[model samples]
Target: MGNGTRLGRVRGLGSAHEGAGEWWKHKVSSGSNLLLTLWLMVSVALLPAYDFATIAGWIAQPLVAVPLILLVLSVTHHFRHGLQVVIEDYQHDESRFVLIVLLEYFTITVRVLAIFSILKIAFTTTGVAA
Candidate 1:
């Protein structure tokens, strides 16, 4: 109702569907990913070897275990957001959209399962030491 022009008034206003909120979430997630990636690199360096037992030993340490678990969770969440954006953009047809949705769900499920498995392995190793 003020004297602002139509385009000027609408310039910064985002979609009604919460696109701005999603963008903010993406920024936060990306920041967390940056930190997590650094921790993951250090974790990999601490491993004695590529063998299962050696890797398990490294992961069982509280210093590595906790951050790796958090990294897994945060990275998966960030990846899901990216995949959703891609799905929204590149998927046009109804059938293709349905396929992309299914693929996204499957990807998320697999990622969560892998994270749980890694946590389980780490904790089991920790328990074995006690």
Candidate 2:
């Protein structure tokens, strides 16, 4: 039952399609994540006490609102990109492709909605409309 080898029958297998751009995007995303994480950690640590009204006021401040919203957006974006890459690498198939695209779009939409919500909160606190 020994046919020596199957190497001679192997054909048409192409190389992977990964590019340098994906790697660069991942690096940039990681860097942004690191910065955002640091900001979040430091902000949480600076709070001596966490009360509902106190926290609301902090979130309303322009200084805190802008960075906090940015951090959330950046982190969400990074997460979506990283997960998409992981899915691309590990999942290979047409159905998976459609699912991955849907997932990415959903995550991005959620990120935008979250940022809008944060902006709404900040604006409301400052007594502004729209």
Q: Write down the RMSD of all candidates, one decimal each.
A: 6.5, 7.2
Predicted structure 1: lDDT: 0.73
Candidate 2 lDDT score at position 15: 35
**What digit string (tens of lDDT, one per residue) describes model 1 on residues 33-81?**
9999987887677655778777777777777777877777787777777
Show model 2 residue runs off by greater than 4 Å.
1-18, 126-130
Give per-residue CA lDDT, model 2, range 19-75, as digits (tens). Answer: 577677768878888987898798888876688666767788888888888887777
Lowest-sum lDDT 10-residue window in model 1: 8-17
The models' CA-based lDDT, in order, is: 0.73, 0.73
Each candidate's clash count: 0, 0
> Candidate 1: misplaced stretches above 4 Å?
1-16, 126-130
